[model samples]
Target: MKNEIRVIGGRFRSRKLRFPDAPGLRPTPDRVRETLFNWLRNDIEGARCLDLYAGSGALGFEAASRGASKVVQVEQDAAVCRALERNRALLNAEAVEIVQVEVRRFLAGEGQPFDLVFLDPPFRQGLVVPCCGALEENGWLSSSAKIYLEAEREFRLDGLPLNWRPLRGGKAGEVGYHLCERTFFR
Candidate 1:
């Protein structure tokens, strides 16, 4: 059976999205998303966003609903990417783009800096540090970009870029969610 989730706010509020059963495809919980966006209220509008490891495309689509100028959702699984495409079409999300690729490979290539980023990789695989390093080293972040990261509640976000400063964070159940902004002058 397919799993379903709803958009929490903005133009897509209450809209349901369906996705095939795929491993590690958990969508960000609605309450957590609401809090994350609240932390980003001032920065979300008109921002360009990147949703790395775009499971369920929740963060990317939410940014589009809230008026982000552009959003790129990168996911490796073919079925997951198709679901993301379906949701984008369903929402008429012209500002959003879905890419079927490995997150690290995408980051290795030339990057167009984004104003906001959602970096919610799968939990408990040592992905956070390497991905964070790639984003900072490969020119994927605009100066002063805001990044949202989600991981296992016990995961320690060590070895991240020095310039990325934690602005807000909280834990809900087993998930630890955080918002960080890239500082221009470290």
Candidate 2:
């Protein structure tokens, strides 16, 4: 994410923070971030947010900026985690926590629930299904939690766990947001 840090839409607009040139770091696009934050603006405030595969801490820091009570980020890549930490500090977002761990392991180890969880694994990784299931088993999500899932537009989600239901999705260039909510099965 060598590109300059750009705030989607808020007080930090046009502010360029340091974004290291790293391969594992693909910051979510501003247009998509803007739409996501807009859709979540009301609920995001005061929410306990979790960001999985938080490369550059974009989503997590954004949550903090928008008034989330606390934001926890998980990223497996060491360099990416470092970048995330730097970005968090640059944004002056002290309410964010960055944990260097694989998405699966973190979900498997989670001991508490979050109000909102953002899961944006790399493209073609097929992480959503197992991650959600692991989250449930590990007590990482509130029963009423909302999960924002993202993937490549062409990725077919035929095997996702029964708990998730697609809410809103649209392609922005090559990436897509597959917003899903926890739903009852049986």
Q: TM-score winner among the candidates?
A: 1
Q: Which tens-of-lDDT digit does each residue in 64-138 have in candidate 2?
A: 887888999988888777877877777778778989987887776736978899988888777767887787668
Scored by lDDT, the top model is: 1
What TM-score do all the candidates reach, one by one?
0.96, 0.89
Local distance difference test, each candidate = 0.89, 0.77
Taking the tens digit of each residue's C-alpha lDDT, what string does model 1 give over 1-186?
358888888999999998888887788888999999888888888999999999888899999999999999999999999989999999999999999999999999997899998989888889888988888888898989988899999977688899888988999999999888899844
Candidate 1: where are CA atoms >4 Å away? Answer: none
TM-score of 2: 0.89
Error of 1 at 142 (Å): 0.8
In model 1, the worst 10-residue window by lDDT is 1-10
